[model samples]
Target: MGKPVLIIISGHPATGKTTFGKMISEELKIPLVSPDGIKEILWDNIGWKHDFTEWSNVGKVSFELMYYFIETCLAQGKSLVAEAHFHPEINNARLNALKDKYGCKLLQVHCKADKSVIEERFRQRMASDNFHPGHRHGIVEVYGEEKFYDKLGKGEKLLNIDGEVYEVDTTNAENIDSNKVLEFIKSNL
Candidate 1:
């Protein structure tokens, strides 16, 4: 009924991005585009091998699907929330182009946590057999604890999207303040 808004939930691993994204998706009634979710589907289809290099192909295909969904949602004038780490090395031009074409507002929610807390959660996730395969591998084990911490510490900065941005620190708590995230989305909507 109105212009679609692209709510991007982004941050370092284990920072509660997915949790916040799910809440926003429910509250706003928009679809969630999560690469991690795609990776899990890939795992279900191809099976998880517990191999170190499994994330590479999975990530590629997952993002391909993600972009397709993004384009479709924007084209059809449907608001959506996309979840991802949004690392600095990642490009934003594609999303920007879509925004310019669709006249959609890009609302950013940046999740964060303390370094030690992130390390503990990441290690715990890596050790969990039931965790998403893409979430479990490489982030902590392959990069090692030091590099992983460093990466999370120097996490990505926000892009210059033409909308408001919200930050949540979920270091000590299991629950994020979803109400605040929802309020932000509603305000923008």
Candidate 2:
């Protein structure tokens, strides 16, 4: 089988990673695998009684399920787009290892947005029913708004990747140009 393409759309919360992933998935016509989406499903299926305190455990399971999905896709010679707020130190290494194991072409899309814009978007999401429980009920519930903002203010430090990277700035949400990102992925593929 030919090597598959694995596109990673990653960034801090509210940076529009999911939106980018969706656009890329549609353009590439491949599955979109989201750890947060998987976590939501796990929360709904496993119940949220331990969500706040056991979120790490829940996240671990969700990541496991995500990799399972990736492995299945690789075995089928199917490409995929995965969206997440990946930890630079850890998840990047894992992704690299997976690329080696599956011989898949890896393209990383790093997303960023203005802090104030991200915070506003985050607040709006928290007020909405669509807010991820893992964020609203887990992280925010434990850290509170003030602390959450403090950490977010420090900002996310992205790790370096070996291959091509496309940076997308979504500060002006109305002006996000997904075509650029798609073109980069298609060119890399």
Best by lDDT: 2
Mind sharing the TM-score for model 1? 0.85
Note the residue pairs that clash in candidate 1: none
TM-score of each: 0.85, 0.90
Show pairs that collide, candidate 2. none
Query: RMSD of model 2, in Å?
Result: 2.0
lDDT of 1: 0.78
Candidate 1 lDDT by residue in tens digits, 1-189: 389888898788888888888988887678999988988888788775544566566777788899899889999899999998665456477667778998988889988888788878877777888786545454545445566667664645565566688988888685666787778778878
Report the Cα lDDT for residue 146, model 1: 68
lDDT of each: 0.78, 0.80
Question: Which residue ranges in model 2 land beyond 4 Å of their true spot?
Answer: none
Clash totals in order: 0, 0
Per-residue alpha-carbon lDDT of candidate 2 for residues 79-158, written as tens digits (9 for 90 to 100): 99878778888787888887788788788998898888888888888899977565677755655678887666245646
Question: What are the root-mean-square deviations of the candidates from the true structure over C-alphas?
Answer: 2.6, 2.0
